[model samples]
Target: MVARKSAFSSEYSWFKGNLHSHSTRSDGKLDPPQVVELYRSNGWDFIAFTEHEFYSYWQELSSDDFLVLPGIEMGLDIPKFGRCHHLLGIHKSGNGAKHLVKAPPAEKDGMAGAQEEIYRLGKEGYLTIYCHPLWSRVEWEDISELRGFTAIEIYNHSSEMENHSGLHLDHWDSFLRRGIKVWGVATDDSHHWMEDYCGGWIMVNAPQLTVADLTEALVAGRFYSSTGPTITDFGLDGDEVYIECSPAKAIHIVTYEPWGRSFYAEPGKSISSAVHRVRGNEIFVRAEVVDSNGKTAWTNPIFLDKKA
Candidate 1:
């Protein structure tokens, strides 16, 4: 079989979006329309109103420029971990007329119940995202057995703002090393909608703004997560991987090994591109660009021996 390459191309448009957010339907302070307006005015192409255990804003409010994807945040308390597993489900369509799928009570179901709920929602045409692993204190073993997830939140805005336990790059790398074909996402997961909004987002390259096209792009790994920097282009050619991004102070090529290559710019200087050769022993490799303002953009891992 032919190797799978990056799905980014010049033919598609890069749309910035935040897939996890909350509204008054759940524990969030803002209502659905206010949440939509908050993201829209901040230059978001799409926003999923992922209310806690509720999926209501499907066809409620949207516009020609901005799209509101159907989604919900399902949570369950794990007795073993002493924390909750919050799963973000961005559905291809609304959950019928009721627009809500009540979660199993956390007291009785626990982790097993959360996994079952994830599977059920997966079957119902939802893109499942394991949310805030670090914030929840979820270890690698806790998620090793779980399946049916499209992505994991590498950076959760609210989680970081509230508790400073948001960045989960180690958890994501562990999953990739274990042969999980999961993608990484960054989201605001905005509750207060003030300091949390626009902090984390994903830039998706899709043909259009429709749910189908965006979902396809996400599943195909045609996107990159960012706190500030923008990944203009990235691809592999022969043994070398090329990356072009916004002006950055440093560009790092990280792998499943102790050491990886990095390029640094001089003080007050910004570099926009770099190329690195793939080492043979490397299991997988990904790129991260850090701009001068301490913001970063992260690319999904590309397995060296297999297509990604």
Candidate 2:
């Protein structure tokens, strides 16, 4: 059998979305409608109202152009670490079951509770993401032990705004290096406390603006997260990996190794695309684009040993 390859085609359209946001149902400033309007007006094709321990706004807020995905930010207080662990569960189906929506009890808190909840929600057809590990001051040991999460927040806008604890690439790379098949996602995690609403979002390649399509695309890793730049295209061609994006100062091919390939634009010149030869020993590779304005976009990893 021939070796499988990773590719991105022009058959699908890119939909911009913020997968984590809070409304008045939780500790957010705006109500559900206001939150929806904010994102819709700002050109987001989809939004997930991941209220803390609640999943109420499903059909009530969905529309033709704008899609609302039902989700909840499950929080558990870890006794050992004495910190709260938050997980984002975006349901595959818009309608959430009662049991999945409810939070786990305090007795089942901590690492075990987190793993249990992730597995449980995953069984119920939810995409579970470990939310803001750095912000939570989560130790690597704890994170490395957890399983069953679909993705982890590499960049969290709210966490960055509140504290300088948003970017967590090291934590993500650790898991990827260990053979865990988790993807990376960047979200606003917008409580709207600061300028967090549109700061971070994902560009998903889907057939249409529907929950099922979006979820499928996300699970398949046909997306890239960004704070500012747009990744127009990215894929691998034999030993070389290429990325096409908006004008950027730098395009980096991040891999399982500590050092990866990078293409930098000369002073006063901006580049929109670059290609790099992939090292044969690399376990996986992803792309990161940094615009002149200092904003960055991150692509999901492409496993070298597996079919795309």
Candidate 3:
């Protein structure tokens, strides 16, 4: 018998997905068919239709064969002179029962408003992850306050273009230093069905290929992030955190601690890296793999829950 590909093999351990996208229901230029075709053709296991204010209105799919997630992007702005734009809501599992709770507005217009909406989503039994927290005017309190954020994107592929500058890693370093326990997701955040738009993605480890399974894993932080590379695994012990990577060149193990700072363990070229001296009462650790071709991958934080 020919050597058959093992779906559960470590080499093919993750399910590739896009967490943010738009469709004809919102301002995105592509219809469902074209958008679905683009992602499916690119080998993505799943893609969410997070339109500006409404779910993709998925009734558009001629067949439910594709792993399409129903999600809505709730955009709210900060107070006077505060340009911070926030996104609330969830990439609802289209296969599940309807989620009827609408997030309430924290304020008429401001971060407070966005907060209320997120809380509402939570009340309705959905976990909301803050999208592009540093996008344009989006700002927040210290990394320590990140306690409730379901998760935040350390890197958003679509918004990475910082004006005329290059790659925008944003304030991800700050969150790490604070020992914030959150998953880092890399999403295409695509709107136009363009190839360059799907530059970001997350590799999720799920028992099976399905929206429900993937969504549950993501909410549990059982995944990693990347623009192009891929992370194998990450974990933390007493005062040390360990990680494993793929096609690994140089590995970076980053830990975020209290007193608002971060530390790094760069082990030149090893598939595994560990941080020995953890700081303060808490330490959130993650790992990165820089592929030989310059591409890179990231694993979600393996949190060290030390309460003081």
Candidate 2 on 11-36: residue-level lDDT in tens?
Answer: 88889999999877788989888998
User: In model 2, how large is the Cα lDDT of residue 146?
Assistant: 91
Q: What local lDDT score does residue 139 receive in model 3, on the 0 to 100 scale?
A: 47
CA RMSD of each candidate after superposition: 2.5, 2.4, 6.6
Give TM per candidate.
0.92, 0.93, 0.77
Best by TM-score: 2
Give the Å error, residue 116, model 2. Answer: 0.4
Q: lDDT by residue for model 1 over 218-289, one digit each (tens)?
A: 888889999999998887776777799999999998877645789999988999999887766677778999
Compute the lDDT for candidate 3.
0.60
TM-score of 2: 0.93
Cα lDDT for residue 193, candidate 3:
42
Instruction: Say which prediction, candidate 2 or candidate 3, comes out ahead on TM-score.
Output: 2
Q: Model 1 segments beyond 4 Å from truth? A: 1-6, 93-110
Badly placed stretches (over 4 Å) of model 2 are 1-6, 95-107
